[model samples]
Target: MTLLEVEGLRVKIRTEGGEVTIVDGVDYAVEPGQVFGVAGESGSGKTISVLALLRLLPRGATTSGRALYGGRDLLRLSGRALRRVRGRELAMVFQDPLTSLHPMMTIGRQLSEHVRIHEGLSRRAALARASELLAEVRIPDPKRALEAFPHQFSGGMRQRVAIAGALATRPKLLIADEPTTALDVTVQAGILRLLDRLRRESGLSVILITHDLGVMSSIADHVSVFYAGRIVESGPPPELLSAPRHPYTRALLDALPHPEAEGRGELQAIRGLPPSPRNRPPGCAFHPRCAYATEASLEQVPLLRPVGERRLLACHVDPFAPGP
Candidate 1:
């Protein structure tokens, strides 16, 4: 079942000069117990799309289009109604644990407070639940860690705690933004394993947003490649990873380091920086950096077209098309 659906979603930030579009007409859906990955370079509007769903965008930012969660329109919800949904029905594990964690508060207090608010549990009960959550996320000695401050934990541990907090309420949907970015390889693997286990055990839907295509391939059931505020392609992980139809998606996959190809040559990196939201390209946003772009691509934007079952690509020239 589809637990969350976002259609034609557009987000613009108001500035002194004019409106700068950050998320442009993106569409995606997440089903129960499915991990939908949103992959893109920095400034591709990955975070903004999640923020828009929670109505957490900063001042002067405007969002339009439908965000339906459980058949209710999230965009139309009042602040109070939204608050009731957040942390209980839908929760977010932020990119930075330190930023999300209150420095002055103990880990126990932070976790318990959320439980008390959302679950209306007693302090004692909340603390017990918090301890279980910490252990569930694979933290060592949950009792001792509860009294520790955010600074006391390592980067990986802090992120685990953050994930614990998000799962405290056993939310139906979890949005994890760059959940493993700051961790080492070992820690990243551990975190990913824990997330996979938790999702299976709890049957929780997830939205995993990151720039790492390898991570997405491993964990995501469905994948969406975003470039300059728009989703250029989306499909099941195997299809998208094995035979990416969009140029941008192929570029990302090629950029991944391959130990087998070590002796071949230097690693490939996508040339040029992501375009500024204030000055996006006229037609296809990625044409400025796309090697395959031609004059035809520069003249018109391509809407997502069906390439196969559950696969869509937004590109003028299909990579899978027969050669001349």
Candidate 2:
């Protein structure tokens, strides 16, 4: 079943020069108990897209879209209506727990407060639930950890707390934006495992956003490749990994470090930086960096259209098309 659907989601921020669009015409859906991955490099509008869709953008930003959750348009929801739905139905765990978590509050206090607000439990019950949540996230000695402050916990522990808080109300959909970005390799694996287990055990849908293709390959059921404020390709993770059809997606995969290429000196990388939002390149934004670009591809933007069963690509040229 579809848990959330976003269509034509556009976001703009008031810049020094004027307003500029950051996310343009993004569309995707999350299904029950599925892990949907949004992958892209930094400045590709991945984070801003999700934040704007959830009405969580900071000041000077605005969003427009039909984000349907449970058949209701989230964009049209009143602040109060949205608040009622946010934590209980759709929760978010941001990239950095240190900044997202309150330093002054004890771990127990933070989690219990969130539990009480969304679940309407008593102070005593909420506190007990908070400890249970800590256990759920596999934190050792949950009760003792609750007595500590945000800064008292290690990076991995703090991220666990953030996950526990998001799962407090058993939200149907959890948006984890770059959740493992700050963790060490080993710890990053553990966090991804926890999220995958939660989805399997609790039937919780998750939208895991990150720049790491390795992480997505391991945990994501389906994946979307975002670039230059648009989706370039989307399909089952296995398919996208084995047979990426878009030039940008191909470049991204080729850029990953290979164990066999150890003696190759410098690792492969995509040339040129992603275009700045304020100074977006004309036509297909990726044409500047693409190896297969042609004269036709430089002057026209491509719509994200279906190219196969459950697969879509937005590009002027098909990498797998029959040769002349």
Candidate 3:
């Protein structure tokens, strides 16, 4: 069963010039217990797409399309109806724990408050629940740790608290945007492990948005490569990572540092910059930077179509074709 199905999800915001499309015709599904990863460079609309589902987009922004969660259209939901779904059924963990967590409020207070609101538990009960949540995230001495403020804990610990807060309501689906960003290598590994374990233990589905292909390869069952507010390619991690069907996905992999090439060669960088949402190029957005771009790529947008088993590609050039 699918936990969430987003189709033709478009987000536009009014600018001085006119309304600019930030997310254009994005579509995907998150099955129960699946880690659906959205990967791309910055400004690819990965973060804002998820924000649209939560209705957390900035004022004056308009979102179109269907975000069907548990058979209900999240986009069409009223404020009160959406509030019922936000914490209890769907929750989000942001990139920066410092900004997400309250600096002045004790960790317990923050966690307990969420539980009290969503679960309707009394203060004492909520505190106990909060303590358990901290322990679940592997916070040391969780009971006492809860009394400490966000600043008292290390960066990783603060992130764990942020994860715990999102899980306080036992949400079925979690959207983690750059959850491991800014942490050290070991801390990043730990956070990734924590999320994987949580998914395994609770059958929780996740929409993980990040630019880290390493992170996606490590934990994501499926991956979507985003570019210029659209998905360029998507498939299971093994096939998608090992042999990308889209030029952009290929370029991204080539840009990753290879251990064997550590001393032999420099990391390859993708040429050209991502287009601004307001002035996106016609046809394929990645054509300017793509090595395989052809005349067709500049003429019309390629629809995301199935090219292989469980794989989707949006490009004029087929990487698997016999001739150039």
Q: Which candidate is the best by lDDT?
A: 3
Query: Candidate 2: where is the Cα deviation over 4 Å?
Result: 260-266, 322-324
Question: Whole-model Cα lDDT per candidate?
Answer: 0.90, 0.90, 0.92
TM-score of 3: 0.97
**Clash count per candidate:** 0, 0, 0
* Most TM-score-accurate candidate: 3
Tens digit of per-residue lDDT, candidate 3, span 1-324: 888999999999998899999999999999999999999999999999999999999998999999999889999998789899998899999998878998999999999996898778999999999999999999999999889999898999999999999999999999999999978889999999999999999998999998999999999999999999999999999999998888899889989987865596778899989999989999899888887789999989999999879999998888653354
Instruction: Give lDDT tens digits, candidate 1, residues 1-324.
Output: 789999999999999989999999998889999999999999999999999998889999999999999889898898778898988899998887768888889999999997998778999999999999999998999999999999999988999999999989989999999998878889889889988998899898899998998899889999999998999999999988998889888888888888876587676788988899999898888898888888878988888888779998999878565356
Candidate 1's error at 289, in angstroms?
1.8
Angstrom error of the Cα, residue 268, model 1: value is 2.5
Q: What would the TM-score be for candidate 1 when compared with the true structure?
A: 0.97
Q: Clashing residue pairs in candidate 1, if any? A: none
Q: What is the lDDT of candidate 1?
A: 0.90
TM for every model, in the order presented, reads 0.97, 0.96, 0.97
